[model samples]
Target: MTTIDPGAELKARIAEIKERFAIESAGGKLTVRRDDGLYRHLEVEMPKSSAYWFEVMTWPGALAITGHTGSHIFRRDEDMLLFFRTCMGPGPDWKIDTRYWAEKVQPDGIGSTGVQSYAEDRVKAYIKQAAQEAEADHPGLLAEVEEELFSRYSKADLETEAGAKAALAAFEFDGFRFDTAGWEFTEYDYWFLYTCQALAWTVAQYDARVQVAA
Candidate 1:
């Protein structure tokens, strides 16, 4: 596989999206290496369709996630929530300062809380609606299927090498589509994540999201 420059990819994507989607406020930002990681930050405008996919895949629990192009603020205590921040930006212009915190709900629920709690009713409703549509459209449910298969194992087991092997053995999203509600568990979550990265890489090859100053 060839290497990619995330900054260029982000800008090109934004312009391309603006042209094709025809949404004025709909835009994106890219940030590279703010928190020290190999992957580039991508904060897309989160179109209705993509937002549905993001929620189904990430599955944030008991916290609120609010975001826009330059900012994506997620409130969750789970360890993965921290990683969510990095995932917010596309390449080099995303921010995580206090100004982005528009509201906080339900007080911190646990120790040294890392995420914000907002009402889940809206997102839940959207997710439910989206699931019905996906079922009809047959868009492929990799994340849900994978998470369910892996959920059976204890947290400790998931951390061990044996657990990883056992997990992958359970299911592979590419081969099938899982028809389930609420994502009980699956072995395909990690596989789905990596596969998504690979998909993004593939897209970048054909359509580099390059930034062009206005």
Candidate 2:
């Protein structure tokens, strides 16, 4: 399908959110609310009949959401969107940084490590090429080699350089080569398969948390 660009996509989503919601900010607090939207069409906190809205909060190491609607946790077709960034830890602009998660893959910052997140198309093409070259060098080489390794030695034996070299000798037969290192993994990128899961969990936390608070 389509490739992912997490940072760009996040920004776009934030912009669209701005268009649909009214945002209020002061010091360590922020609020996002909507005017014309009703609460029935949305998945909200099920308030006991009152106004409804939605919110998203962010800081150095925290993110949260809160809202209400027409009545009884008024659900709405479109949600109120409020985004907050405090002047607490880091500077005001884009406070979330390397510490927000891991380096390299997550934030697209490559320093000493040679880490990179690959697009699906490139990954697929690379796999196809590597497979073609590998099969050409020796048919069923990878599978046969694995079976031979297990049949020849125990896990301890394979731990040694000599044992590993011997077991994987097929890889060096005539001229077989492949990039053994795959692309890097990160939570920040939309390409990350877990993006949806993570977002759902964030909202779930808000749901559980507000329920307890109320």
Candidate 3:
């Protein structure tokens, strides 16, 4: 079996997206149009950290051009390209910091003190489902995933309660108002694992698209 280099594959995918969609950027905004002439405008906001957040609005009407909007945050340029590709396809419904984590950590009817417990329960549930799927479908890819994880995060960094709190602090973003101090150490580790899973799934989706086009 051939080992997949995610960095190289991501670069190629980004290039293909630029060529196929005629993506253009100017004055902090990236723009692209669909084959049907619907246009998407992405406004990016760069924070002090390397991660950038974006809000995208799409317009379908020729005269009025009214459509919905969505937002996402990406830690790298390659992630932004994958975001664009997913937008062109089914339109991404996932909002990492704002929607997903917020809902998990602060579900409806939950008070402040319940946040950690709620998040822990949800993470535990997700891990069980994720492990089953990973074992069944992609056992061969686990080592590569682990290597990528270690490159981004130290084992020591994820093993302790203090490290878990620090990881949450480092990854905190605007519009995601939460108290990381309340989060359990296991929750932090699960968050990192979940992020890696999401990234791998996105790359797989992009690869599938490429194969279908070919």
Q: TM-score of model 3 relative to the true fold?
A: 0.19
Better of 1 and 3 by TM-score: 3
What are the per-model C-alpha RMSD values against the true structure?
Answer: 18.2, 15.1, 19.4
Each candidate's lDDT (Cα)?
Answer: 0.33, 0.33, 0.34
Q: Write the per-residue lDDT of candidate 1 for residues 110-160, one digit (tens) a residue.
A: 532232222123222333444445544544553463245334542323343
The TM-score leader among the candidates is 2
Q: What lDDT score is found at residue 11 in candidate 3?
A: 50
Task: Please give each candidate's TM-score.
Answer: 0.17, 0.25, 0.19
As for candidate 3, its clashing pairs are: none
Which of the two candidates, 2 or 3, achieves a greater TM-score against the reference? Answer: 2
Clash totals in order: 36, 13, 0
- TM for candidate 1 is 0.17
Candidate 3 per-residue lDDT over residues 62-147, each given as its tens digit: 11111111211232223344443444344333223322332322223333412122233333233233334454455543343334
Residue-level lDDT tens digits of model 2 in 24-133? 11111212232222221213321323343234333333333334311111111133111111211333223222222223122213332212233333333443455555
Q: Rank the candidates by TM-score, best first.
A: 2, 3, 1
Q: How far is candidate 2 from the true structure (C-alpha RMSD, Å)?
A: 15.1
RMSD from true fold, candidate 1: 18.2
True lDDT of residue 182, candidate 1: 41
The C-alpha local distance difference test score for the whole of candidate 1 amounts to 0.33
